[model samples]
Target chain A: MLGLNNRDTRFFLIVIALTLFTPFLLQPFPEGSAMAQFNAGYPDLMQRFAIYGIFAIGFNILLGLTGYLSFGHAAFLGVGSYSAVWMFKLLSLNVIPGIILAVIVSGIFALIIGYISLRRSGIYFSILTLAFAQMSFNLAYSVLTPITNGETGLQIRLNDPRILDGEGASQYTNLFGLDMSSSFKLAMGDYVFTFNAGYYFCAIIAIAAFYLSLRIFRSPFGLMLRAVKSNQHRMNYTGLNTRPYTLAAFVISGMYAGLAGGLLAAMDPLAGAERMQWTASGEVVLMTILGGTGTLMGPILGAGFIKYFENIFSKINDNILHAWFSALPDGLEGFLVTIIHPFVGKGWHLTLGLVFMLVVIFLPGGLVEGGQRIKTMFSRKKNSDAASDVKPAE
Target chain B: MDAILLQTLNGLDKGAAYALIALGLTLIFGTLGVVNFAHGALFMIGSFCAVTLQRLLSISYTTIDPEKTDFLGNPAKIETPYIEGWFGPEIGAAIIDWSVPLAIIFAIPIMVTLGFIMERGLIKHFYNRPHADQILVTFGLAIVLQEIIKYYFGANPIPTPAPTAFKGSLDIGVMIGFDPNAIIYPIWRLIYFVFSLIVIGGIFAFLRFTTFGMVVRAGMADRETVGLLGINIDKRFTIMFGIAAAVAGLAGVMYTPINSPNYEFGMEFLVLSFVVVVVGGMGSLPGAVMAGFLLGILGSFASMNEVKQIFPGIDQIIIYLVAIIILLVRPRGLMGRKGVMEE
Candidate 1:
């Protein structure tokens, strides 16, 4: 079972299968069709799905388990990205060293920030993290120009000293001579499935991270973290030091964010201070909350759902809307398009904000809880049906 | 000495805005026991009210002038604002020029109505919920409000200028027994500082003197007791919410001339104001005001060239850094009451 219970192992397998066949599953619509615009099987988006999947899973550990809502988690992600780009600058274009350094550096950042921020719980903790992140972001955009390249972001240069690579190497990020962007496109008539090196690399890491989260969810350490969330006073009375546990969760989640950032640079070797913005941190929070906090799969699902919606919603223009509703009567079609216009196009954030409010109000447990409720409803119906068949056996 | 005086003035100006927003936040928090993440949005809306009025006044109609030739040698189109046509051009021009100040009249009613609706419709239900739930719901609401503004305003900072008279710099240092032109400050910033003091003072006076204010203060201290006295405290809290919204709206109204109003400006101030509120001690009005000015001054001082030379980027982060240090030392903040979110 690979250290998982029966249900967990099954869930894990299903997730792995889904990730493996994502290129197929995501591109359900064939080419040269209107629905193909919604297809998210492309390399760039698939990489994001995996990368943000890692980010949300890590966030869930701290917020869902320890109940310490760190509003500056993006700072760690930014640090990881900066470190990764630095690795690409000084070292070789190999992703392994870059990703390793990213994790280590972000871990250090998390330790320092976590140690300071974890002193106060609740809203105080959230503000402290926010303040720290804003500081980093401002510094990165201004004072740290020597290191961060200011607003332009960090990128590769041909004249740079990459010590590991001999004479001439591909300037692009690579994994043992395999370029990150190198992808095999399998064309089956109307459908095309892309298999990118970066996506697979991220997918594998995301899977491992997801598995580790599952183990943590079931472990005694996770139990302690949950206890910290439930009642810290009781934990203190029980003579349990919740600080170390919370800190560990914070650092672990920080590392997850770091890994996600490193993977982002590995896919496309660039880093920007914008990654450290409070809004970016808020987005990850929205993902974790909108999925289902404390669930192994919920955070990942939330991340993917948001990314997908962001991609699809932002792409819809008046033309597309008109095309979709062209069959409707003229007035009705015009009315529908006008009503939906504000929620689509560049107004995707408004839709997202509204969704977050609705989810917080109606479905606090997120989509997972909704799924569970539907399941129960079906089971209750079956039970009622069975209860009405009493004369059949007689 | 001049440098110090100038920095102090700059700091006080910055603090004035912070204090106003923080005051509103504390008022709502103290009265309703709700952590309003949407308060910043209300401030942004208030700023936009200035922009809205400015745009409204400049609603123009074009006419082809027979005498004026176009660049293409045709008759030129002379665009005249509707206000210019209805009122005299001079009066209409003055009205447009003083849009920022004029926005106060427009913003007060709008912000108060929005506040009343917010309390009655959304926040009333969240009173007994966990603080986290309150935070999330408000955060969502803030996003929605901000996005709506962005949709209309196009994410750019609209430059709403101060009146023509106040646009010039004032050499106040000489009047205060300093060298001539030793410390020159903008008139609008000075006005903003004085305006904030007036608002702050008026609020304090109202809360201290008025019968309603006394009842509300009592309700803040002990809601159940006020309720037992048969004095419908919830309606009073809603009214307080409206007043707080008006205070924030007025702050935003005056602030447009100093800093061009943008959709994201609210978010920018939101964190800083929250810091001020926390540093002032949650639910403490005077504390919120005090912390706002103190941090604003400290932040200004941090941005000084001498300070920046030694601790580069200190200007950007000094307020937050000070907040962290204070929180660690005094977990309850500078003037925070005991047992008010002490945990």
Candidate 2:
């Protein structure tokens, strides 16, 4: 709401509809098409899309709203994931309890870390968080080996006694008669579209999160957060304690990461220490900046874009390039494939670098601003014509 | 006492590297105010330079030797370098034999040009951006650089051996009269420590004595004021970047023999070096150099058996534990200046 106007709401709805329905529409792409790859229908990837989207959204609340650049958010996510997995192992595998545990644990962690880290603002805050996150990562990797399972990653073993199942030792049953692994598919004229049930479940959760964010954006609490972002010292002089507000934002965002991590473990019951790594934390920052920080939809769009490209681009190989380029001249095709070969698979990272660089350089406001500029350009032409036509009527 | 002495010796070699890399990082941050996430990548590239030199020297074509027999009673296969065809056998063989030592000359120019390109091409565009943006872009650049290295060299670590003359360990225990092998240390590591000290001393002396270094130091203190005095601060900053790059590169080259060169090696050093830089005070060169060795020795001690007995897993988090304590007690770090971040 800070950035969005009335028209933007309509555009956002359209984009969301497109994002949701595209999978169903692209079902019949003869197994492989550019459109088919966009099927946000796969359970694994769609779960990730929602999980990472939630993580980015939470990140944006602090970074975008409060202007504090945290470099260690992944520690909370990792902590949340570990907490949730432990809940599954120790208590019930029902996701709700697991998620609640994750949020509570991660919030406590953020409370401690934020209390100290938020003492300094700007770059110092960033470095402090980074240092603390590194501490968490190291601890998780080594000292907490029994809890985190060290480098091999923490997973749900068959030996994990499902106490909720009453000594039956079976996997936890899904609540509400909703199958987590089930997929909904539609077919029409060689086009088959499939959507995972977990996706819809995740989608519903995302919408709820988005609505909460919207409410936050509109509330007096959000205003205080913005004021803190603009000028903390001034807010302090105005008799409003900035500490509580900043800490609140930190805890809220930490819970959001916790929820995401919990969902990730639910959809796939494995949590690795690598999830808590500084690089993983840095990734959400990149996603937020690249999408359009501070906007409700920006982080979601950024998450989808990054994940899609990461998956699809890494899948591309020499054969794929050769298939497309073979339609050209014999010599030219070979040359083109070789040129494109290095930028795919492991080389996909190069593309990510270029995208990040371009986004930072030319689109500082991110894709949200880029979209706004395009809309303004189109609307200006219509507005000018309407003004000239209205002059005759006047 | 012997164990303590050995650990101290172990730390000096590591401390020397930490100082060298942190010096470069602090130099760039001091002059440009940009937190370079790619400094580690430059260190990585420097190590690869050694790898390349080893590859270049070892390039040979195989040929069947009709007169000589193999262990299996077959004709022996002899290998000859391509250089032998162009140059005379004597010079070619000598050059091939001595390529690892010759990599220093090759690495200098390559590393310098890479520094110039990095500063001019990517970092130049981010000068006006926020620190976060600079961090992100440079980080992206670091990933790209590391990925390229991985693509070329594969994921495995490549051992870059030192010259044959410096292959064995030096027995410092015999001289000190504690058991003959108690203070045994690698010859290359000793050489590296000495080399680092000379380079560090030379850099310090240059800054202390030279007019160029004086102007650079002046620029670091205040760029606008130096610019007002009709000096080209941008040029000095660029040269400082080059110097920083060369320092990291040389550190990396010397380090190749200690730990094998791998794509992810820089990331490990990068994290520790950042801690060193923060502990040393963000823009203080002397602080960086001092803290590098301090942290290195402290970390080494934390990993020792005696330290482990006191704190079960202290080694895993010793650097960060120290960083947190320092930030809490002295937020501006040990020798940090006023107006620096004080938590």
Candidate 3:
């Protein structure tokens, strides 16, 4: 059971099964079907699902467990990416060294930022993190142009001194000659499934990240983090220093974000300063909150839900809307299209904003809490049915 | 000396804007004890009011004129704005030219009503929630507002120019014993600075002199005691929210000519204004005003070639750097009262 309790073992196994079979599960629709547009089994999108899942999972460790909402996580992610791209340029096209360097560089970056930002709690802490992130972003865009490549971003060139990668070797990212872009397409009857090496690589790392997070969650350290969130003042009164604990949590989460960033560069060997923008940081926060912060499966679920919606909803346009509602009466169809127009296509952000607001207002615990409520409702109904049967016997 | 004076003037105009926005933010925070993320959206909507009025005035109808012929030999058509028809053409043209100033009248009621609804429908419910939740909800609202504006305005910065009279620059170097043309400043920028001063002055006098302001200040100090005095403090706080919204709206209205109002302008200013509020002390009015001008002047000075040569890119992050240093050194900010948001 990998040191997990019975229920946790089952939950972990289920998650593993889901991630392993994602290529099959996501492609519910067959090839050439109208609904195929909604299928998200492609390599690029699937990799994003796993990568951002890791990002949100890491973010939840700090914000969910310790209740320190750092608004500067994207800076660490950006640093990781830049380090990864640099490794590709200098050392090798192989992803191992690049990813390792990414995690290390981002960890140090997070440590410096976290140390300074954690000085104040609550809104002040949020603002401090925001300030640091904005500063890093500005520096990356201007002063640190030599390192970050400025606005054009850092990319691998043809004639770089990649010492570890032999002369005339493939410039693409790879693992021991296996290209990340290489895929095996299985066409069975009307359905086609793609098994991508890059996706599998990202998937394996995501699973490992999840398992590590699970261990951290069950550990006494996690319990201490929860205590910090619940009552840091009381923890201070108990003569115990909580700074190290929160700082550790922050650094670990920063490492997780770095790992995600590394995987992103591995999948596509390019890094941009836009990755460090505050909006990117806000996206991860949105994913964590939407999925159910502090829950084991919540961040992953939230990441998938958001990525899926972002892809599918943005693909919808007026033409598609008209086609979907063609059977309805003209006036009614026009009304529906007009009403729904603003929530799709380039207007996806509006829908996201509305959903986020509603989630914060009503479903504070997010989708997981909603699921729990439904389960309890059904169980209550079953109990009532049994009581009615007993009354009839009496 | 002229260079210094010119930069100071430039800083004063920028500071005026920052002070106005921060003052409203501080007022709401002090009175309601709620951290509003959507305050920037209110500022944005105010700028749009000017755009909206300009658009409304420019609506035109075409009339066929038999007296003139088109290039195609068809009847010539003349397009005339409804305002031009209602008033004389000269007067209507003047009105359209002065739309930015006129937007002040148009934006006040609209911004105040929007603020009232935001407080009653959304913010009122979040009063007892955690600060994190309040931040999230308000942030969401800000996004929604921005998107709505983008949907209408098509994501372009609309130009709302000042009146023709104030379009030119004024040279003050001659009068101040400097060489001719040594210091030339925009007339509208000067107007904006004076206007902000009046607004800031009015807010202070209101707080210092009025009974309503007294109760609100007392409520900020101790809400429970004020409520215990059988006063409907909630009503007054809501009114305070309206006034704050009006102040922010007026700032946005006047700022239209300075930086052609765009949907994203509110968010751009929001971050800087938050820094200003924090540096000024979260709930202090004078502190907000002082910090606004001080940071604005410092910002301009940092961008100077001599300073940039010594330390490059200082102007880009001077405010944030100052905020971080001050927050660490003076945790309560410049003039922050004790025990407010300490937890």
- Candidate achieving the largest lDDT: 1
Q: Model 1, A1-394: lDDT tens per residue? A: 9987777788899999999889899999999898999899999999999999999999999999988878889999999999999999999999999999999999999999999889899989998999899999999999999999999999989887999988768879999889999999999999999999889999999999988998898899999999999999999999988889999999999999999999999999999999999989999999998998887778988999999999988999999999999999999999999999989999999999999999888888887777766766776677967444332100
Q: Among all windows of ten consecutive residues in candidate 2 chain A, which has the lowest summed lDDT?
A: A385-394
What TM-score would every model get versus the actual structure?
Answer: 0.97, 0.93, 0.97
Better of 2 and 3 by TM-score: 3
lDDT (Cα atoms) of all candidates against the true structure = 0.91, 0.82, 0.90
Ranking by lDDT: 1, 3, 2
The C-alpha stretches of model 3 lying farther than 4 A from their native spots are A384-394, B66-76
lDDT of 2 by residue, A1-394 (tens): 4355666456546656755664553243445565454444556776678888989889988988898999899999999989888877877666777788988999999999999988877667887898889888988888889999999888877677656645543374233345566677665566655677677766777766775676677578988899988888899898878998999999889889988888887777789999988889988988898899888778987887788778777888777687777789999999988888878876887788778778877888788778876766676787966433331100
At residue B87, give the lDDT of candidate 2. Answer: 88
Error of 1 at B271 (Å): 1.0
lDDT of 2 by residue, B1-343 (tens): 9998888888988899899999999989988888898999999998999899878876889999899999998999988888886687878876765665577788888888888888888787777777878887888788888888988998899988787778899999998788888889999889989989998998899888999999998998888999999998898888888888988998998899889989988888887898888888888889899999999888888889988989978988888888777776787878888875443
Top-DockQ candidate index: 3
TM-score of chain A of 3: 0.96
For the candidates in turn, chain A alone yields TM-scores of 0.96, 0.90, 0.96
Residue pairs of candidate 1 with colliding backbone atoms: none
- Candidate 2 retains true contacts at a fraction of 0.59
TM-score of candidate 3 restricted to chain B?
A: 0.97
DockQ of 1: 0.78
